[model samples]
Target: MALTNSKPKIAIVYASATGHTERLTEMIVDASVSQGLQPEIFPVKEFDLKELLRYDIVVVGTYTWMNGEIPRQLHSLFEAIEQQSGDLVTGVFGTGDRCFATYCGAVDLFRDMLHAKTQLAATLKVEQMPSAEDRLRCDAFMNSVWRKYSQHVENLVAAKP
Candidate 1:
């Protein structure tokens, strides 16, 4: 959906296996609100697939499953978003254990697909949990989302006759 000069609608949706992804979601939410953009939050189970197009930007959070895999809970959501995808600005974040051969593999997976299917803005991956240092990355992630949204609005304006 193309956003007008009004604040662009954004949704932060996630599937947290053991709460790590949820914590990261909270961080992103806090930072976004602090920056004056109120994003709606949805646990993957609670989010309605039909409502995907209501927002101009969609942020996804996930926890990597064993040996580099997208958690089963997120597979449908992934496909649903992809099926309806376009230039919907997207941001992906994930959490995982360092011992895994592919740490944050789900984030990488979503990142790759979103880069192709949507207007991928930024991506972030955290170890099991976030630290104070990770807050900087979270802030940067939000900045990237906003920056991309701004660019999209500019393009829309430029395309006008």
Candidate 2:
């Protein structure tokens, strides 16, 4: 859809317990800035679910815990997202120890749900904290999301009466 005159609002909503997800969020935010786009990052508890309507792009980050279960704190957001119409563009990413069978399984869970509920763009999985090498992957993820969003906006504009 054609965005308003104002720049698209992007949100990086995440839940990080041991700070790995938070660190990844920082990397995403930095990549966004480098692309000349400003994005706001919010902890899952702090983000008002209703505010989701205001964003054109939504990025979710989390850490996979025991048995690949979605963390308790993020469950609400997960449900809220699933209830949303499939219009918003979305990306999912997370951190998990590679030793686990379900490494970054939380990201997979979110990916499935978001694909059903929104326009899923990219999904990323990083083992533990992101290292310097992961920056390229992060950039590619952001770029893919932005490219899809831009295409959507262009399609909307072209369809104008």
Candidate 3:
């Protein structure tokens, strides 16, 4: 299907202390918009679980802390997401210093939790200090997601015939 005509609803929610993750979320939102999808951005602190359930795709972004863990504020949001166990399609992303032994630690946590509970559409690990390459990577990842998701929806529609 043509992305502009897909009318897919996408949400990019993130927890960021130094703004890197938040910036990445914005990039994803921009890409979504360019693809003709309805996109929204929410900070973990300001996110509403009920609103999240309405989206066809939920992209969760987080930053890793000193101990390779998600920020405390986002922990509760993650728990809430896990508890719902709805059929919402989900994706994960994270920004962290590549110097760390466990790069993109938060992405790992998000992936593990979602795999153990809900269906995951994709996972993107973006670098903390983004360069031109990083931006291209993020755009590519978003494009792949849009393509895969549109295909999934198309298959569902075709099966109903």
Candidate 4:
């Protein structure tokens, strides 16, 4: 049988207390679809490890809470990713208040974990209540990261001689 190449599947998962992170996830989903890729959105609280591993690319979103730590639900997911042996390509984004001591706290946590664990593709940070420019920058960042990741995957597939 002849094999056909297909577009990669992308998943956007988020944990939000005040909806900021969820909104960002929705934006990523929309952008991914607009770029002619398969994409889905999931709340991190309801995300499953098996489902996450199925995606070729995963975008994680979170809102800062308490200090600069990830929420309990997402911590579990991060732990799972850390323990797994699979190479999960990931992008990260978050929303937080700049007035706080740490701006984009959730994003900070993601950077730390990604540095220690998975191969982090990119990270975008937005204000808690993002401005028009912030939104534009976030969208642009997503586009650039997605394109880079796509190229990386293509190279990997082509190099499998």
Candidate 5:
């Protein structure tokens, strides 16, 4: 379990319709940069599912659709993730309106799947456009995910000869 001393690869994959999720992506990227970690951003449609395993960390930003259903665009990525061997550290976040019965159900759906498929670090959901309050939450999410990865690497090193 000894992770490489080099920096871990990080990818932020997301889907946005009304731009709320995209905004969240910006916040996450900013937070990661503030923490000195560079994360590559990918739109769900453009990201190659085949390239998923190349990253040590994956963060998904999604939008709910059709009453809590995960966006159709996300289905392939979801399945690909679930099929992985669970070494990836993942975080899930999304945006939705409160009027929906499921709120940000897309995030919840991704959360559950990632939890089972990878080392899940954090899950975040924001209403419509993000507010100032959500920025703090974004920082917390970045901290949590980084902390999870750091602790795991530390454990590996401690257990090393």
Candidate 6:
């Protein structure tokens, strides 16, 4: 559903093959709540491109595959967000094995395009599932997003008169 509210909407959309990315998504969701921001979590397959207009912030998570290709399920969302989310703040995160040459390469792929398209608040790369040490990074990512959203709102208000 399209959102129309004073509360800034955030969506954590992701693709997870082995559940590692999902674990990261949960951390992001919890972080958003702790920031006093309600967020919607969607699998990349279930996300609607048009729903992007409803959000002020968008976070994407993925697991890197062999080399660094974006998962097939996320390719379309990857392209669509750049086209639609220019005014929105965005963050990208992923989980991957550091043993690989391109650790969390999928995060890099998304990060490049998001920087070109959205406000690209923060990008995080976590090796596999998040551990206690990663909690600080997750909180920082969420804080960055909240700061961008707040600044955007302030700018809007200032511009109005």
Each prediction's number of clashing residue pairs: 0, 0, 0, 0, 0, 0
lDDT of 6 by residue, 82-151 (tens): 7874678899999999899988889999999988988889999998778978878899999998887777
Candidate 3 C-alpha lDDT tens digits along 21-134: 878887777767776777778887787876756677778888888767887888877887787644455788888887888888878998888877655767888777555566
Candidate of highest TM-score: 1
Backbone clashes in candidate 1 total 0
Clashes of 3: 0
Give the residue spans of candidate 1 off by over 4 A. Answer: none
lDDT (Cα, 0-100) at 7 in candidate 6? 78
* TM-scores for every predicted model: 0.95, 0.93, 0.83, 0.84, 0.93, 0.91
TM-score of candidate 6 relative to the true fold = 0.91
Screening candidate 6 with a backbone cut-off below 3 angstroms (N, C-alpha, C), the clashing residue pairs are none
Candidate number that wins on TM-score, 4 or 5: 5
Q: For each candidate, what is the lDDT?
A: 0.89, 0.87, 0.75, 0.72, 0.89, 0.85
lDDT of 2 at 41: 88
Candidate 2 residue lDDT tens string, 31-145: 8887777998899899999998888888999999899888889998898888887768899989999898888889999999998888899999988989989888889999888
- The better candidate by lDDT, 3 or 6, is 6
Between which residue pairs do clashes occur in model 3?
A: none
Per-residue lDDT tens digits for candidate 4, residues 1-116, read: 00124666677888888877777776776667666777777887667787766766777888887777778778877777777443556788888887888788778777777757
Q: What TM-score would candidate 2 get against the native?
A: 0.93
- Model 5 poorest 10 in a row by lDDT: 1-10
Candidate 5: tens digits of C-alpha lDDT, residues 9-55: 89999999889899989999999888779899999999999899888
- What lDDT score is found at residue 103 in candidate 2? 85
Better of 2 and 3 by lDDT: 2
Off by over 4 Å in 6: 1-5
Off by over 4 Å in 2: 1-6
Clash count, candidate 2: 0
